[model samples]
Target: MHMLKKIGFYIVAKFVPLLVIMLTTYFFSRWLTPSQYGQYSLVISIASGLSIIAFQWINVTLGRLIPKSSADVKIKIINSGLILYFISSILVLFLCFIFGEFIEDNFKTSSYLIALLAVALGGFELSQRIFNSEERVLAFGIFQGIRGVVFFSFALCFYYTEYIYPGVVYALIASYILLSTPNIYKLLFLRKKDFIPNSIKEIAVFGFPLILTYVLLYVLNSSSKILLTVMLDETYTGYFSLGSDTVQMIIISVMGVVQLAIYPIVIGAYNKNDEDRYNIFSKSNQWVLLILLPVTAGFIGISKGLFYFLLPEEAYLRVIPIVPFLIIANLFVQLKSLIFDYAFHISKKNGKQFLPVFCGAFTSVALNVMLIDGYGLEGSAFSYCIGCFVYMTMSYLIGRKIFKYPSIDVGFLFKVTVSSLLMLLIVIQIPNDSIFQFVISIVVGALSYIALITTMFYPQLKKYINSNN
Candidate 1:
């Protein structure tokens, strides 16, 4: 019952933020035109790209050390991570200053906004890493929930201002500052005695490789949008980002909550000498597959109506056609981030993880360069999917060998695949003319899936219950 309550809290935490994000997206999709939204998306993407470069290494270092570190050492690691972030942020700001003119012209955004976005983004993310490592689910939930509400409130205020898209960036900066205040306040009490100068060097040496790995991952996700904007225009970029981001939201709403609920246990167990950690990791991966695979299929099944409801008619037409590719690509990305990449972390072979991401980014960029000129949007979308596939599968294949993780669960795979196919067939056959019909079809499909899966698991469920008795 305690576990159940903890899981419930994590869900509320992730769901409130996710719901707010979806609502904001829905409103913004129509309130702002494709061009405006595309530019706004581009601004956020660029800021994210720069921020990861600054924070990824520190993120990797903390993820590895925090789960097992003593209290004093944990303070050292956090303070060191902050120091690294500060130095990196300063470096990033300098680069932005030098490239301010080019950025302003190319991205339709200012260097000032980008820098603020990077600082806020890095701070917020660093705080979450601490929360995740410490297994502070309630704190994680509270902070994330607060950030979402603050963001939405300020976002509405700025949307009507003359600043428009840039106003949205300001709103984000404000929310991040507000949410990270408690984290920042706590840091002030860390003693200078705890700060290790060599710890900085160790973290730097270990985390440097991950910087590129993260940049490659970012490339796998955002390179397409960047290239599309350059080769085509903002409208096409907007269409692609909308489909991709929507699929991402759904994946998070389903799989992310499960991960949050279980991730602390998995990390915590790994810090001690125990065989149970692998089992926990395997079970979590199984949950990811069981939930996401079917959700991916069903998302594609109802994507037409979903987009129609969310986007303006003109944008809907362009977005729906590419959503399948977007869905496939996003599934792989999430799977890699949440599950497979942990193998590299366990082995402390961060460099080995780099190759797959590098290759994936290379493939994505090469394909985009080749395809965008000839086939345009569809071409770029296809490239994104293929690149993600290469990255995800390669990471699993390579990581398992470096450190043996669980083998593929064939029986579970078959069960979910069958259920997903059945759900897909039932959903597509249903007429999806209005949002009302869309809701009904989704409900029917979900109920049908639940019924079938429950039956399939009945034997195991009974056996488990009998064993418990």
Candidate 2:
């Protein structure tokens, strides 16, 4: 399928579900205190990290190989991946059981929560990877949409239950299980009896390094909130988490569709004609900047509007000031993870990918320890930004040594930057007196950016449209 159509399908796929999540967050803020939400966020973050550990390798290993593999190899990959999934799930749960009570007290949830979440989130995530790897864009989108609706419905229901935090989680787990039901037999019964067990060894060698890499990545993402919770209080953690989560949502919604669509296509390009891989990578990077820069700039442009009933709760209003920093920081983080570090996957020596992320993670943690006591929340945000810059820079620098570096079109980047800045200038100048006006400004800014960028590509677009007709 054409890349544009794939991305368009994913836009609906990601957008609606994320929209539901964003709205759900607003309600969560209204429904629970910052401290309560902080506790909830902490548990969720830990479970998310566990989910990454338990399932990421399977998804990523398959994702990297599936596009180019023969049908027999694809079956081996899936079946062997399931074996790894079972082993990892059991291992994580066993460890969680051992540390159960301590975790519950420390993170403010049942320790079993991680076990459930690791299974639930990890299970569906593996399925999504399969859908994306197979280029089943519509299936992927529908799966996510269903999860979003189920999450919304159950979350609302769970809020009134006695154990609100755990109930919220149960709602999400239920959704994953609901969608995952049909895949159960397919995952188990469809396994080839003649599968080579060495495929398991092959996967371990390919993906083992990623385990620690994810620990560092998790530090870059959530350790700050954890540190805040320890250094100050859960309220502070909640404030920081809300901003970070919103930024994460935006980055994923914008760039994730591109990455998902591009991953397999680029992999196919690498296998068929290695020389074309650079072109594919380069073009996709350009598109990422085109969409991400303007959207991020616009989001930061009127970020203060977030406090104007977007959060609804007065306590969360405190987060507005730091939200922009988090937005910029996370933007760099995603650009690094989704774009630059893709070299490692293609390099097939993903082992070497660890150092840059380690350096960045160390930087963020050290800075947080040094600054958070004095500068407080803002310091954590600044540390995060600087750390992300280091990660992206180092990844680009080192990643080039591993594989052919995708040549960045500096000229195109400049044009996109200029267009984004102009759009930001126009949007920032708009009076944000009312929520209505604030929303209009966002619409206006988006349209302005689109118009400016589209104008730059007008001749090519016109030629393509004319040729198509």
Candidate 3:
């Protein structure tokens, strides 16, 4: 129903464009030298980092706040979030300018690239946040599609014109601009404006906790690359990031579908405050694991071939060892996110839930700094794994202490664990022919997962589907 439709739309919107963008980026990297590709990766990492830091939780705040208020009030929240984002972007730009020379000299990015990257970062945050707010899921997809089109088209144009670096930057800037245009138009015209909140203080209050959550979440996710950048060098940072990126494609692509479907359902459940709804939430997590576990195991098992086929040989071969670890870590990270972040937001404990998040963030940052220099990317992976484990454990304890919900299902864990382990075995025993091994691994792993779910978890899924229908 609604959940399926929304999830379907979200997947189409986010993943379709992402697939195009990934293909474009892959080719772009192939066309460029290792150093050039490394620099490209570095700039993108920094831009993403800036977006994370600058986002300030407004998007989450809006998602929570918008439906609760009158349309006018929602408009105000949107405007307020936009204003906050603009100011934050300006602050980020200032910081970049201040550190630009040092970063370029030491970190291998040029000042001009940083400046352009700053603009791209700002636009990306604003437009993406607004897209989430509008819940114009298809529009969001189109926005991403436009970004890919503009980026690849313009870059190719510039590549042909013998302006490589500027071409890439121009592509990014133009794509962001194009993607953001719809929001800009909405902000400018379509003039049924509402009571714009006079003070952003209330919004800030709600958003501040998520800001902490976002940063901690960032640490959980991206701090590895940052630490790698510091502990090793830009080139290693590039390799580690690419490997992380490869695994993340698995996590995010899958999780993205789950989030779109489950989030609004969670919100509806919270609003209703019914145990039945809570059970639905629990079952959904089980379903996510039922699907995610084998996928993760397969990725870990066949990561080398996947990376090699998808990326340049040099980049793929060097980063192969890191992929399996990251894939596992990403699974834990996704679990932590579902149990901790989404669970809290749904249960209305977001206001007072900063403690565990801060604890995890500090732990992640500390462990990353301590580990990455010694073990390089492996250390970062270990830190991520440890941080998410602690965070999820803490969050579950706190969630139980506060809400007394059925925090997790033991049956769900047992089934998923068994399925994941079995799939891992099947995949690891894959043959020497790389392509054949990959194909067999995917087909066999998927069939095994579906078989398990149909036999064990199907009853629960059927009940949920029947109830909804």
TM-score attained by model 2:
0.92
Top TM-score: which candidate number?
2
Worst ten-residue run, lDDT, model 1? 101-110
For residues 107-201, could you state the per-residue lDDT of candidate 3 as single tens digits? 53455566657566666766766666556667777767777877888888877776776568767877887776655665555333532545367
Off by over 4 Å in 3: 1-9, 70-73, 90-119, 158-169, 190-193, 274-277, 346-354, 365-374, 429-440, 457-469
Candidates 1 and 2 compared: the better one by TM-score is: 2
Candidate 2: regions farther than 4 A off = 101-109, 188-196, 432-435, 457-469
For candidate 2, the per-residue lDDT at 422 reads 94
* Tens digits of per-residue lDDT for model 1, 1-469: 4445656777776776777777777887876778887887888898898888888778878877777788878878878887777788788878777777665465434677888888888888888887877778677767777887888788788777777676777888888877667657766675677578888898899888787788888888899999999999998888887887777877776676667766766677666553677777777777777777788888888888788878888888888878889888888888887788788877778889888898888899999999998988889999999999999889988988887687668998899889988899999998888978999989988898888788878898799889989
Better of 1 and 2 by lDDT: 1
Tens-digit lDDT track for model 2 on 313-403? 4655577777878888877877886677778877677877678888888899999999899988899898888888888888888988887
lDDT value for model 1: 0.81
Clashes of each: 0, 0, 0
Clashing pairs in 1: none
**Pick by lDDT: 2 or 3, better one:** 2
